[model samples]
Target: MTVLDVTVPFSTQIREASQAQHTEAENSTFMSDLLSGRLGVSAFRRYTEQLWFVYRALEGVTDTLAGDPVAAPFLRPELFRTSALERDLDHLHEGADWRSALRPLPATETYAARVLEVANGWPGGYVAHHYTRYLGDLSGGQVIRGIAEKTWGFAHKGDGVRFYVFDGIANPAAFKREYRALLDAVPVDGPERLRIVDECRRAFALNTALFADLAEATR
Candidate 1:
């Protein structure tokens, strides 16, 4: 029996395939304003509130997919950001409870609904959504975290930015390497692999839409 050796990692493939979508989101006006220190704290709060809805939907599907090989490996507990989001919300809103702030924009609801859809049935598809959000959070999210702290003068890089702080993982670089390895080892290929990559691109498109909405809303 010849064991299959996937010389090319799926993570790299997904990254390359989704490059345009990723660039679109990152270079969007909304992200540019937020990163370049133009967006006020209220805009950040709105973003945090919207993220709460998306992460809840994403995390809500984790337990049911516990047995799924392709999906299971991606459900890392450390990646959960719900509580952190709540903490940031609380601080951002100045001790007002976060539940009152749970308003999801149309784009946010649409983004989250798709996450729940795949998470419920398609394991490979679930991995698509999971890889998009969590990996992005671990990578580019750190920059937003810094921006929030510096913009708001968050005390000790404090509660206002907890969502981007991964206290569970001491080394994000090494953890990302492990995560990519898991993506490489996932027993999915052929058309399904392409499907996952397409889903990833769609995920970024949805993200870009959310940013556009944010920019319009704030302006």
Candidate 2:
């Protein structure tokens, strides 16, 4: 079998694990409390804005790789949704300028710093690993749907969870194929491939820790 076949199963496993762990009801409550309660909308607003900034910064990197001969074939179309989510997040509060709503958090700086450090060390297949490992947690598409439908349904219409829609993506299979192709294209020896896989796992752990930190901050 080809590398594409090998990698797709790995990617699918990660996504399945993420889906299993993500509790929509719990996430909805947390998001609702963050958006509407004394924890302050400013915190969530600032966090979302910072998330946008990070995505914008990464867009150039992604585009560069997507155009590269070695990486282009493997690049998933869904990857473009990163920028879309950033744009939606920037507009989340609407009417009220997001700039004024920004409350600088040290946690934001720390999180960005760590992620940047990791990105700087990325190998050829790193981007695919990044997507496979963290996309589900960061996107939380299904959980976001639940949150938006239950909490912001009446107040914001569909605008509140624009980040969740994936531009009306009803199927994820084709996208996964593209992603696997990208990973299979990475030219690497056995040890380097193992290292890249290890880094991917590390990336996910870091992301989970970051969310835990944010959850603690809210409490």
**lDDT, model 1, position 109:** 89
In model 2, which runs have C-alpha deviations exceeding 4 angstroms? 1-47, 67-71, 74-78, 100-107, 114-121, 133-140, 154-157, 168-170
Off by more than 4 A, model 1: 1-7
Candidate 1, residue 175: CA error in Å?
0.3
Full-model lDDT for every candidate = 0.87, 0.49
Model 2, span 1-219: residue lDDT tens: 123234455545434444423343224433546544445544454445655544544443555565565445544454544555545555566645665555434555554554455444553444534564335533454554464456544233245455555544456555546555555556665555555555555545544444555566667
TM-score of every model? 0.94, 0.63
Model 2 CA lDDT for position 78: 48
lDDT of 2 at 73: 54
Q: What value does the lDDT take at residue 141 in candidate 2? A: 48
lDDT of 2: 0.49
Q: Using TM-score, give the best candidate's number.
A: 1
* Best candidate according to lDDT: 1
**How well is each residue in 1-219 modelled by candidate 1, as lDDT tens digits?**
212225667888888888999999999999999999898988888888899999999898888999888899878899899999888888888787668646788899899999899888788888888888989999999899887877888865579888888999999999999999998888976678888888998999999999988999899
